[model samples]
Target: MARKAAIIGGGVIGGGWAARFLLNGWDVAVFDPDPEAPRKVGEVIANARQALPALSDVPMPAEGKLSFVSTITEAVEGSEYIQESVSERLDLKHRVFAQIQQVAPGVLIGSSTSGFKPSELQEKAPEPGMIFVAHPFNPVYLLPLAEVVPSPKNPPEAIERAKEILREIGMFPLHVRKEIDAHIADRFLEAVWREALWLVKDGIATTEEIDEAIRMGFGLRWGQMGLFETYRVAGGEAGMKHFMAQFGPCLTWPWTKLMDVPEFNDELVDLIAGQSDAQSGHHSIRELERIRDSNLIGFLRALKERNWGAGKVLREHDERKAAAFFGATDSAPKAAPLEMAHMQVLPGWIDYNGHMTESRYYFANSETIDAFLRLIGAGMDYVAAGHSYYSAETHIRHLGEAKLGDRLTGTIQIISADEKRFRSFVRIMKGEDCVATIEQLCLHVDMAAGKSSPASAEVWAKLKAVADAHANLPLPEGAGRAVGQRK
Candidate 1:
C-alpha cells in the first residue's frame, strides 16, 4: 500500500515538500488556513512538474494526487507522516503541534522550523515522540538535503523511518545528533548572514556582490563536495590534518570578527534593498528562479552520473521513487499490455476528416514499436554498432477511427526469428479494443556497408531468447499475412 503524507501551511516550503512527495508517488493531503492555498500550491507544482523530471535520466514516477483540506485534523486523519511548515513563530508552531497531535497519534510529525529546537517545540505538544524538526533548504524539491533533528524523547525508530521516507522523496536526510537551537546547517548560515550584513553596513560589498562571490566561486564546488572536503582535497597528500594545520593560524588573526553581530536599522535595510534593486534591474524573481532551477538540474545530474557520495544518494532516491510508482499494488492495471508506448489522438494529430492521418498512424505505431525494441535493448546504440534490424515490409490493417484524447496503446509480439530475418505481430489498442495490427518482416542490416547481412551471433541469441519467452502469448488475430509467406 502507498503511504500518505500530510503537509500543513501550504506556503513555499510546504508546497516544495508537497512536490517532492508527489513526484515520488506518495499521495499528499495539504491543509492551510489561506483560501488561496490551492492556487498557490498548484502554481508551485506546475513548475515542479516540468523541472523535476529534467533532473534525472530515469522516467519520473506517476504523479500522486494532491488534495486540499480546510482543517489540519482532516488532512492528518490517516497520514503516516505530517510535515508542519507553518510560520516560524514558537507560539504558532506550538499551537499547530497541539492540533496535529490530537489527530495523528502515532504518526511521525516534522516541523519545518529552521531555528527552533525539538525540545522547545515539544513543550506545547502532548507527546514528544510525535514531533521533531525537519529543516529543509529553500526550493526543497530541487535541493536534496533535509536536516532532521529529533527530540530526545522521540523514538529512535521514528527518526530512522523518517530518514527512509525522506530518501524515497529524493532528499538526503542528515540526522542531527543533538537538538540545539537553530540546529546544524542554520548556525553556519546565521554566521554568514551576519558577515553579509556587516559587509553591507561598512559598504564593502553589496548584496549582489556577496551572492556573486558565493555562486561564482565556492558555491559551484559546494553542491558536489562540502567546504571542508574541497579544502582537504586541496591539501594534497597530507589530507585533513595538514590542511587544518596550515589554516589554523588564520583563525587567530583579526581578519574576521567571528563573534560580532550586526544591527538591523532602517538605514541598513534601505541600503540593502537599494543594492538589491540595482543588481536585479534586468530580470524578475521568477526568471532568476527558473535559471537557478535549470542550473541545479544540470549540476546535480552530472554529479549523479559520477556516483559520488551525493550522487549515490540521488541514485538510491531514484530507485526508491521507481519502486513506489510501479510497486503500488492497488493501482489500476495498465489499460493495455505493458508492451509499447502509445499516444492518444490529440488536437494536433487529427486531420479535417476527424480521423488520424494515414502517415501519422504509421509514425505513431513505428515509434511505439521502437519504444518496445529499446526496452529490450535493441535501441539506437545497438543499431549504430554496424548491425540493426530494419522493416523490409509492413502490412497495416486499420479497423476503427481514433478520435482526440482517446486512450491508446500498442503491443508487439515476435512471431518468428532467425539469423537474417525476423517477423513481428503488433496490435494498436484503443481502450479494450484492438484497433489495428501490423505484420512486419525485418531484415538485419549492416549499416557500415549498407547491405542486408546476418545478425551478430550475440544479437541472434538475445532475439531468440526474447522470442521464446513470449512465444506462448497469443498474436493479434486479425494480423494480415505477409506477401512472401513461409511454410
Candidate 2:
C-alpha cells in the first residue's frame, strides 16, 4: 500500500508540506479550521505542480490526490505520519499534540515548531517518544534544509525515521544534538539581526542595503558550501591551522557587539520601514516572490549538476519519487495503449485563417512524439548534450479543418529504425475523427557541429529494443506513407 501523510494546519507552511508530499506521490489528508482552507491549499498545490518541475532535471512524478477533512481525527485515521503545523503558541501546540496522541497512537507525529524544543512539545502528548520536532524554513517545498530535534523521552529510532521521510521529500535533515532555545539556524540569524539593528540605530546602512550585502556577496557561495568550508579553502597551501594563526588575533578587536541587544522602539521601527521603502521604491509582494522563486530555481539547479551536498539530496529525492510512481526495475512497464493531453492553440501558431494553421498539425504531432522521447531518456538535456535525433523530412496529409478554439489529440507509433535513423507515424484526431496524418524520418544529429552523425552504440541499442517492442502494434488509420510519397 502507498504511504499516507496527514497535515494539520493549512497556512503557508502546512500547504508547502502538502505540496512536497503530494508531488512525491503520497496520499495527503489535510485538517484546517479555515472555511476556505481547501481552496487555498489547492491553489498552492497547483502552483507547485508548475514550479517544482522546472527546479530539477528529471521529470516530475504523477501528482497525488489531496483530500480535506473537517476534523483532525478524520485526517489522521490510518495515516503513517502526522505533521502538526498549527499556531506556534506553546499552549496551542500542546492542545493539538494531546488531540493527536489520543487518536493516532503509533504513527509518528512531527511538530513544525521553529523555536520550541521537543521536550516542551512532549509534555502535551501521552507518549513522548511518538512526538518530535521537525522545523522547516519558509517556502518549505523549495528550501531543502530541515532541523529535526527530538526530546530525551523520544525513541532514538524516531530521528532516523524522520530523516528518511524528510529525505524522501527532498529535504536535508540535521539532528540537533542538544535542545537549545532557538536551535542552530535561528541562533546565527539572531546574531546577524542584532548587528543589523545596531546599524539601523546608528544610521550606518538601511535594511535593504544589509540584505543586498549578504545576497550579492558571500551568500551565493554559501548555498553550495558552508562558511567554514569556504574559509578552509581560502587558507590555501598552508591550510586551516596556518590561516587561523594569522587571523585569530582579530577576534579580540572591538569590531562587533555580538552580545548587545537593540531596543525595538517606535522610532527605530519607523526608520527601518522608511529606509526599506526608499530602497525598494515600489514593487508588489507577488512580483518579488516570483523573482525570488526564479532565482532560487536557477541557483539550486546549478548546484544539482555537480552533485554537491544539497544537490545530492535533491537528486536522491527525485529518484525516489520516480521509482515510487514508475515502479521498481523488476516490475514491467505499465502498458499505456494511448495517451491524451489538452493543448491550447497558441496565437503564434494561428494563420490568417484565424485558426490553427496547417503547419501546427505537424508541430503538435511532433510534440507528442517528443513526450515519448522523454520516456525513453531522449529529453531536452539529451538534445543539449549533442546526442539527439532531428527530423530529416516529414510528410503531412491534412484531411479536416481545425480552428483555433478546437481541442485536438495526437497518437503516435514507431514504424522502423536502424543504427542512424528512425521512422515514425503520427495521427491528429479530433472528436474521434482523424484530421491529419504525418510521417517523419529522423536522423541522429551532432548538436555541437550541426552535422548528421550515427547514433551511439548505447542509444542505438535502447532505440532498437523500444522499436522492436512496439513494432507489432498496428498504426492508427489515416497514418500516411513517408511525407514525400503519396498513399
Candidate 3:
C-alpha cells in the first residue's frame, strides 16, 4: 500500500522533506501559502533526482505523487506522517501543532524547528505525545541524518515509530536523549559558525578561506570518521585517553571565541558577501548544488564500498531496498549475460592521452562483479550472514581506447560456477565495439572461519541457473588466454 506524508511549509527544508518522501515512494502533500511553492519544491526534487541515485546501484523506489494543497487539514488528513516546517516562532508552532492535532489527532507530528524544542512545540498541543522534533539537515533528500528529539511527555512508542518511518525513507534517525535548545549536530555547527564569524570580523580569514580551511581539512575527516574517532586514530598507539591528557590544557587557552558573536552590521555583511561573490561568482546556486551533490555522491559511494561510517549506513539502506524490490516482484527475472554496468567516462578517468586510463577498465570489471553479486543475492545481508564471494584473481585485456564522456557498458557472462568457486568474463564496450575484456575468478569464503567454502545452496542455485542460461554462448577468446607469450 502506498503511504502518505504531509508537509505544512514548502520552503527549502519542507521541500526537501517532500522530495525525500516522494522519492522513497510516499505520497507527499505540501501546504504552503507561497504561490511559488510548487516551482520551488519541483526544483529541489529535480536536483534530488539527479543526485540520490548516484549514491548506490540499488534502484530507488518508484517516485510517489506530490500535491500542493491549500490547507494544513487537506495536507495532513489521513496521512501517515506530518512534518511542520513553518517559521521558528513558538507561538506560530503552538497554533500549527494545535491545528494538526485537531485534524489528525493521533498521527505523528515532526517539527523541523532548529531553534525550538519538542517541549515548546507540544506544550499547547492536545496530544503532546505525538509531537517531536524531527530536525533534518538541508538538502534533506540527499543527507540521511534526522535528529529525533522527544519531550519528557512524549510516549516512547511515538519516538520509535518516528525512527521507523525515518528509516523507511532512508534517514538515519538519531534519538536525542534529552531535549535542549539546539540538538547535537546544530550545537557543533553553531560553535564553528561562531568561530567563523569571529575570524571574518577580526580579518583573520576571508569567508572563502574559512570555508577552505574546513572543506580541505576537518570537513573531509568528519564526513568519514567523526571528531572523536578521527582524534582517536591521531592519538596513535596510546589511544584517546593519553591524547586527551596531552591536549586537555588547550581547552582553556584563548584559541577560539565560540561564546561571542560578531555584530550583523552592514560592513560585516558586505565583507562576507563580497568575499563569497569573489570566491564563487562563476556558478549559480543550482549549478553549485549539482557540483556539491556530485562530489558527495562520489565520496559517499567510495566510503560505502569500504563499509565505513555514513557509507555503511548507505550500504545497509541499499541492501534493504534491493531486498524489498525483489520481494515485490511477481517473479524473479531470468539472468543471462546481464549487462551489469553502464556509466559515462568520468572526467577523472582521462589520462595524458585524453583517453580513458588503463586502470578504469579493471575498475569497471570490478563494478560488474559487484552488480553480479547483487543479482545472485550476495548482497549486504549475505555478507552480514557471514558468506561472500572474494575476488581471488583477475586478468584484463584491452582492445580499444575510450575517451571522456564515452558511454561504457560491461556485460557479464557466467563462465562457470560451483559450490565453492565461480569464474566470469566481463566484456567492456563503448556502444557496440568491445573496448576491454576481464576474466575474473572468485571464491566463496567463510568469512567467520577465514577460508574458502562452498557457497550457500540458495546462492549456488542462482549462479547455476545463470550459467546454464549462458551455456550456449561461446567463451570470449580472451578467456583462459595468458598475458605473456612464451617460447
Taken over the whole model, the C-alpha lDDT of each candidate is 0.79, 0.76, 0.86
- Per-residue CA lDDT of model 3 for 233-318, tens digit only, reads 88889999888988899999999987778898999889888989999999998899889888888888889899987788788888
Per-residue lDDT for 465 in model 3? 84
lDDT assessment of candidate 1? 0.79
TM-score of 2: 0.75
TM-score of each model, paired residue for residue: 0.76, 0.75, 0.73
Candidate 2 worst ten-residue window by lDDT: 328-337
Rate residue 328 of model 3 by lDDT: 38
What is candidate 3's CA lDDT for residue 274?
Answer: 91
TM-score of 1: 0.76
lDDT of 2 at 63: 58
TM-score of candidate 3 against the unseen true structure = 0.73
TM-score ranking from best to worst? 1, 2, 3
